[model samples]
Target: SIASPWPLLGPGQSTQLIFGPSMDAAKLEEARMLLNGMDYSSQDEDGDTILHIYTAKGLRECAFAAAEKLRDLGRLDAKEHKGKTALLVAVTANQPEIVQDLLSLGADINACDVKGQTALHLAAHYGFPGVLQAILSGRPNVNLEARNFEGMTPLHCAAISHSVTTKALSATGLTDVHLQAKANEKLSCVQMLLNAGASLLSQEIKSNKTLLHLAVKEGNIDLVRYLLRIPLPNVKDFVNMKAHGHTALHMAAGLHGNPYQEEILQLLLSRGADPSIRNLENDQPAHLLQSGHQGEQVRLAARCTPPRGLSCVGKTQCIIYPATRIPAK
Candidate 1:
């Protein structure tokens, strides 16, 4: 048989060797020849072509083989109906080598689909470190702050949560590249970035609240503690009672969270934060504490304060504010 028997593949299936799929694979050059004779833009009834099928299958040789040949003809830039290029297809399949080959051919590493996220973005989000390494080896800024349709960064998606990412990134001496805000949300990266010298006082896009506000919202005790070590860059509205009419204190004293409530209050107090500042509803931090269990009052807590403390948690709960908005928000 001049040509081997085709495998009985369904739509979008590329190879069909009667033998085992991996074992029956042909030399990369065979695919190169097939590529030289065909058009990649052609989509069959299944809406996929030879290039799409091979890359999507992660067929190591087949993807690079066809891409190498078509690239020589300068037509590898062909786009599919869904606007996915061959490189995008390869990435979707997690084929790193194919991605590298495509990138070498000038495939846009930053080429985004309709969603405005680069292949590197997707690679990072899915934790494909191998592919991401290949992508960043070309010097993609790990700190480019690239966002998807949802305004999240590749950093936000990679590693674990903000704290883990911060510790990992800090250990790498790449802490200088951490981001404080993504889509206007204060994050663990905020303090890491600040400690590495990011502006501690910067505000988010839609919200005027500082990073402290975000930290409090996440219930991240560590992040909240980290931000408090710096000066509290007060948000204008919070002081004027024009915005939410609640300070970071009001935010920190939220219903379900209490991480770093102690240290946060101290930082605020050291910064001259008044425990007496009331919210729009005329409620104070002590008022928020009232919702807690018996003896959870500020007076008891004040009494518990080290020697020479004259107040009690009850006295402080509804009267005086210890003063911190659990921040890193």
Candidate 2:
């Protein structure tokens, strides 16, 4: 028989067990034995159960084992003080393997926290592609469009998220590698959500901004380029989508000092964004261009004449023009 690492306690003597970073296989086995002897449904001061504590500590083996027992008891979806289940904790912690394990064990994929954020929302908002993928794969009836307290969907959260890598590097300073990786991860999250039938056109209730509006406003040039390239039936309509009467072009043009402002303005024009469309302030994109040489360049790009067979219809409407077709001086 395997010797127990724990000492024999007297009839009424109880001792606390301390798990440390150096815990080994024997310690884990002893811990498992200890856990098996206790009530799995127990809750702590914050209402965190054994599963929540193990999951938060990143104890995958112990957490999943507890999850299995909790599932058997029909308490897997149990919430703690903040109404977060073990599954939600896994995603928030970016533990993809644990997330997959919980999902396989029948955790609630759609359970929301007190803030109304589901696993999908947390994964997307934090740029955890692995966690997002795990949730997508395991979800039976996942709500892709579920809105959070901010009235933003998972896609909305993804659109505005700076990548985890970028955030980490901000304090140590940034590198091209960091920026490119951030762009790729952000784009990957957006693409996955879109492929799973998440709507590109769903606007957040607060500002009525679509994913396109959010991407451009974030000055994410790569994301903006990728978004515009998607083959929607009415690409022009999508390009000119309004948020509070301001089209994406209006937002880009109004980015007075953003480094990517000129490039984004040019890209929008190349993609048939209607610069003539006015915002609630009745300002066309060109009217919002900053003052100076670079702004003049952006203004020139927007003011390029319509192609041979198309014409500006009115002060508020115009035929689309690709920037490549601008007439030579």
Candidate 3:
């Protein structure tokens, strides 16, 4: 017989169940047997409960059992050392089924981890559209606008997520297929948040950058196209909205070597992005164009299609701001 992982304790001493990094059939049986006797509320040295361990280790059966027990004990939202609840862990680990189960069992949807990231924030940041859909479907009152430590909402997190950026950075012929799929997933999450009434214009606290600014900075053309297609009453203003004295056009224009910069610049210009709008450095989008053949192409593109209330002159493109009053620099 295999020796029990739990040690026998003498009278007046209690034995704590020791769990291995991975669970096998025997360990699963042992966990099932110990479930009733184990204290659902107790935390180990790392402040992780049996449920946390099971969820983190991807023990689906053990996690389900532990989560049910935790739910019955009204401790479903119990946090570990970093304040990550099981739901948060499930989302971070990409366990969509477990996330749905936890939500159905009443996990706190708006609970934030130590970094102030909620389950929604994690799902968005990690580009788990399935998990995000589950969270949105399970909870009606989810804080769509909930801000993390950086004051970024789930929409903001999805806009410039690390997953999206990674795909953008390492893109190639074979990876392009995967990148397109991942981009679709990110777009799904963004669309779900928008359908659920998340604010497209909400700016992060640190840089005051909106979703457009982030998408443009990352050279995410899909997101840029999708965002521009939305019917906003102030579409031009949305395109021209400034962050730190720089608009999305400025960011796209200054993307000197980015392969997607020219296409993105064209999209913004077609959407009424004013190239004449200057940043804090007093450089217009046309002025910021990279020098060379590529820069000349971008400059011609800008000059050919000036924004409303602006016109092109001989050789040099000058702007005549409308009497409606131009925005302060």
TM-score, every prediction: 0.52, 0.79, 0.78
Candidate 2: list runs displaced more than 4 Å: 1-33, 163-183, 301-329
Model 2 deviation from the true structure expressed as Cα RMSD, one decimal place: 11.7
- Go through the candidates in order and give each one's C-alpha lDDT: 0.51, 0.75, 0.75
Kindly list the per-residue Cα lDDT of model 2 for residues 169-252, writing each as its tens digit.
454565667565654665677778887789989999999999989878867666777787788898888888899999998889
Write down the RMSD of candidate 3 (Cα, Å): 12.1
Clashing pairs in 2: none
On a 0 to 100 scale, what is the lDDT of residue 227 in model 3?
Answer: 88
Q: Please tell me which model should have the higher TM-score, number 1 or number 3.
A: 3
Provide backbone clash counts, one per model. 20, 0, 0
lDDT of 1 by residue, 1-329 (tens): 11112112244433222112342246776776676677755667755667677888877677777666666667576666666777777776767676766777677666666676667556654444445544555343434455556554454333224544444544566534533222112232232233323344444434444455555555555565555555545633332222256666666555233434654554444444455778779987556653445325433433333223343333232224344322211
